[model samples]
Target: MTVRTTARWALLGALALVVTACGGTSGSGGAAAASERQVQVSATFAQGGGGPAYTYDTALVPAGATVEVTSAAADGGTTTTLRVSGLQPNRTYGAHAHTKPCTPAAGADAGPHYQFRPDPVSPSVDPAFANPQNEIWLDVTTDASGAGEATSTVPWTFPPDRRAASVVLHEKATATHAGHAGTAGARPACVTVGF
Candidate 1:
């Protein structure tokens, strides 16, 4: 081949190589971006209060988003799933996420509900005055071994300014709301939710 023709061909090859290296595609197609972050939590309850021993595992949907405690187990026990939605920020929600396989003690269920606190005051009591942000209420059930599952869609915003905290299960059952501290019962197991 002539020198000039050879040079032109080599340049064309080099240009093609560059284009391929730059991820030139045949059509307008690209990988999809990842969605919001998801957080998963796993908790195990030992033989506390001389009661049952069990393990619980659950997946929390978007980071800082509302979660519906979907499924759970107590020594392989199961229960009816509960739906608790729209969690509030700067407040504590009461939840009983586990309901079954059967702990050692008869009443040794997942104990009481969880209390996310510092919420607003109850409107029913003080008609005009507004209460502080308090806790989320959940509808949950358990099985024979005191194991169950609960889910909620949290409406609360996870504060960016403060440090991350956790949800704790108490040794005793809690009130519908976390009415009294130290009285909600002893903290059995705790699991951190956000980063």
Candidate 2:
């Protein structure tokens, strides 16, 4: 073969190798692994005697992904963010993820504190003695206009058999760091994260 022809063939072979390594130009034909999605949550609060009652627009979690709760409450309510990761799809995850449920009504119940009882145990025991790592807490604080932000990083996996589930924000305060229930209160607002 002529020198020019040989050079042309070599160039074509090199181009083919590059395309194969990069998964070709058609993006859809590449790997089927799940991609990460951005989820955002914003909230507002109603004025209370000492502070403000927490109210959230909604909570979001994408299917088959983990969300990093980056910023829940910040700057004394001027900014708040929460991050959550490793979430399960299509399941109804309680917002508090506490040992007990939060009070359903505003101003009347403190609801359940953020506690996860050890398996096969009693409520009388101190929450600290139980699984403290299981507790998920949200920062509660709002500006004069009752606006705030909450974020969580959640790693979630989608179930191929069913539609993905959602993350919900409650109206009440989650248990404080001290494990006090019935004070977290009620569900003022909520949001569902998807896709």
Candidate 3:
């Protein structure tokens, strides 16, 4: 081949390699894997505050405590992680994604859990919709240093328009029983996360 023809072939080969490394543009699921969707938020808890984070009961979730949340979606699934510091030591706390943002007025303002399938009944005590597989449950246990982390992965992703708005930290671990499913103790702290 002539010099120009050989260079053209080399350039084409280079372009092909670039496309392959970038997962190609064929609208295939491979590209989706390469482009995992993720959202992260970090905030410090405060008492009587107006912010992305609030602590209704400063004893469990003390003022100045920090929380970092990460939500990632890929392969028809979603994983949520919660990390907290400066909380009460040697304690287990329950956390779940909520449908509304955290408000300073009340921890309950965060709304209900972000269920994969909505429950017809109010306060959804049914185990069908309140289970960890259907909801994001991140129960964390703090160490002596008052730091903890918990991660939860579900088999499905959130609908684009119906995503969770916040994560509420409860006073105790989640309960798993009919008539009391998904019930944790009082929500002491809440962190607003866009996921």
Candidate 4:
């Protein structure tokens, strides 16, 4: 064969080797491994139309405060974890998945908590429907340095019609009282998350 033919053969051989080195795109009949979906949102507390919106006190959700929500589903169950940073130190804050996106106007714009079962009310006050088992309650108490994490694993996934849209940070831990069950005082900041 000519030198040109030999070079063409060599190039073809190298291509084959490269293809072998990299795993083929097609699967091997078995179900492909599931991939974890992570949604990251940065929180901000700024003065609203009235005044400082995020916090009732002088404390502010420090700059660079962020919320990270990660979800993985397998074996007929799903686990969701949320981590937050740069909040008020040594304070517990009520957090929940909301149904609306975070806008600059006010925390109210973020809408209500993303309840798995439709509460049939704007703000769910009943403990039966507003408990952590039914809602995403990621209430966290910051350390001295202002960081915390919470996790919730459920047998079901989020609502298909309306997924979690944002995470709202409240000023207090959620309550369990009747007709006041999911009350977390004063939403100071909201982080827009996509799931």
Q: Which wins on lDDT, candidate 2 or candidate 4? A: 4
Taking the tens digit of each residue's C-alpha lDDT, what string does model 3 give over 35-107?
A: 5789999999997766799999998998999999999998799999999999999999999999999999888
Per-residue lDDT tens digits for candidate 1, residues 1-195, read 699899999999999898886664532233211112234544334332321222232221112222222223222222222332222222232343322223433323433322233225432223121122223223334433333445544334333353223344444434433335323344333333332
Tell me the alpha-carbon RMSD of every candidate. 13.3, 12.7, 3.7, 5.6
In candidate 4, the residue pairs with backbone N, CA or C atoms under 3 Å apart (3 or more residues apart, or in different chains) clash, namely: 54-188
TM-score of each: 0.35, 0.40, 0.84, 0.72
* Model 2 per-residue lDDT tens digits across residues 1-195: 699999999999999899876765455443222232333432222222211122222242222222222222222221114443322223223243332222223321332332332334333134453222333445434333333434433323222332222233444444434344323334442322231
Ranking by lDDT: 3, 4, 2, 1
TM-score between model 2 and native: 0.40
Using TM-score, rank the candidates from best to worst.
Answer: 3, 4, 2, 1
- Model 1, TM vs. native: 0.35
Superior candidate under TM-score, 1 versus 2: 2
Weakest 10 consecutive residues of candidate 4 by summed lDDT = 49-58
Give candidate 3's TM-score.
0.84
Q: In lDDT terms, how accurate is model 3?
A: 0.92
Best by TM-score: 3
Evaluated at residue 86, the lDDT of candidate 4 is 71
- Worst 10-residue lDDT window, candidate 1: 54-63
Which of candidates 3 and 4 reaches a greater lDDT? 3
Residues 1-195 of candidate 4 have per-residue lDDT tens digits of 699999999999999887766545433222445333444544444444322224323365654465566666555555667677777788898888788877766777889888777788767999888988888888888888888888877666754566877777888999989889999988877766775
Candidate 4 stretches greater than 4 Å from native: 1-38, 41-58
Which predicted model would earn the best lDDT? 3
